[model samples]
Target: MYKNSIKILGAYGTKAKGFGTTSFMLNRHTVIDAGNLLDALAEDSLHIENIYLTHSHLDHISDIAYIIDNYFCKRSKTLNIIGLPQTIQALKEHFLNDIIWPDFSKIPLENSDVIAVKYSELYLNEEYHLDKQTTLTPVRTDHTVPSCGYIYKVNNAGVLITADTFSLENIINTVNNDMQIKSLVVECSFSSNMQTLAEVSKHLTPKLLFQALKKLKRDDITLYINHIKPSCLEEISTEIEAFRGNFKPIILKDGDFITF
Candidate 1:
C-alpha cells in the first residue's frame, strides 16, 4: 500500500514504447500530476480527487482529459485541479478549452451536484495541508513556462520534487533553508552532449544537473532521478554515474515508491 510512501505512477520525461510520463500518487486520493493516471491506476483512478499540477505541459497533463473522460459517470466527487495561477490559466484557456478538451470545470458530474473538475490557484511558498499529517508547499522552479515544484512534508520530513526544471537555483535555496527536506526528485531529461537542447527546453542533462547540485549544502539527502527522456536514458544514466560526485542517485521508474 502507498499510504505512507509517495508512489511514482509515471516516471519518464516523455512517452516511449513502454514508459509513461510524470505522475505521482501521494496517497489514495491525492496526486501530484496527471500525466499517466488512467493507465497507472485504471478504475482506481476514480478515487483521485485532487490533481496538483507542476505546469501545464502536455507531457505532464495528458491523462487529465482521459481520467475525466473515463470516469465522469462514476465519479462521486469533483476533481480538484490545483496549481500556480499561471498553470491554472493555461489549463483553462488552452488545455481544457472546449476545442482541446471539454471544460469539465463548467460541466456537472453525472447524477451529482459537483462539477467534473475544479481548478484551485495556489500561492507559491504557501503550505497547504492535505490532512493533519501531510503538507504540500509549492515552490518556484525554472522552466520554459511559469512552473513550480512542490515540497511535500509528512511527519516532519520532506521531499523536494523538481518536476521539469532547468535551473536548480530556487531548488537549492529551498532545500538549504528547509530542514524538513530529506530527499529530492530531480529531472535529468537529456544527455551531456545535448546541453544546448536541454537549456533551450528548460530541462537538464547529467552534466548540468550534477554541476548545479554541487552548490547544495546538505549532502545527506537521497537523490532520486526521474523525468528522463527515454531515448537518451542509457546515456544519461551512464553520465549520472560518472558525474554524480558524492550523491549516489537512485534512478526512478514508473512503479517506484519514495519513502521519506
Candidate 2:
C-alpha cells in the first residue's frame, strides 16, 4: 500500500521561452533538483521543504536563491538544502556567499529564531529516509563537476534518476544490484550529431544513451528520458525513435507525472 509519485516540473537541459531546465518534485515536500522550480511551482513553491541537489551546476541549483528570497517572511520552517559535501561547498562559495546571492543559511527569518536555510550533506550510497515508506540513496554519476544520481525507494518499488551523466556503468550496476529499482529517469542532452559536445560536457546523446541502455539487464523497468536541449529536441526525438531497443524510452515533459 506504499505509494509514491514524481511530478516533472522541468525536463529540458537548457531553458527557453517554452522549455525549462531539470527539476522534479517528489510528492509535495521534496524536490530532486532546483532548476526552473520558481517558474513551475509559482506560489506553491512555499510548500517545498527539501531540495536534493544533484550537482553544483547553475541549471540544477539556480532556484535555491529565489525560493528563499521570495518566501522569506512567510516561511514557518527552515528549507533544507541537501547534497554532497562538494556540492554544498560549491553552493556556499560561489552561488550563495552573499556576493552573488544572500546566504540565507545564516540569515534569520522574520519574527523567528529559525534561519531561512539549512544545509545537510549527504554521502554516496547512504540511504536517507524521506518518510516512513520512502528512502533516497545517492549514487555516483560521470559529470563535468561533482555530481550524483538518486535512487528513490518507496516500500519495495523504486525509481532511479540519472542526473546529467555521461556514463551509465555505475547506474546500471546499481540497478542490477538493487532489486527494488523498477523505473529509470535518465538524461539525454544532445543528438548523435553533437556527440563531441556531449562527451565534452559529460552529458548523453541519443546514441550514447542507447549504448548505455544496452548494458542494463532489466527489461521490465520503465525508461523515462529527460533533460533534452530545446534547440536539438527534434533531432534527439528522431534519433530516440529510430533506436529500437528492448525497453521503449518515453521522453518526459515538464508536467508529466509518474506514480509507483
Tens digit per residue, CA lDDT, model 2, 1-260 = 12577889999998899887899898677899999888998988988989999999998988888998988888878899999999999999999999999988898889578988999999999999988988999999999999999999888699999999999999999998877998999999988988999999999988888877787887778889999999999999999988846668889989888676
> Per-residue lDDT for 95-198 in model 1, tens only?
89999999998999986898999989999999999999889999999999999999998888999999999999999999999888999999999999989999
Q: In model 1, where do residues sit more than 4 Å from their true spots?
A: none
TM-scores across all candidates?
0.98, 0.97
Each model's lDDT comes to: 0.92, 0.90
Query: Candidate 1, clashing residue pairs?
Result: none
lDDT of 2 at 40: 96
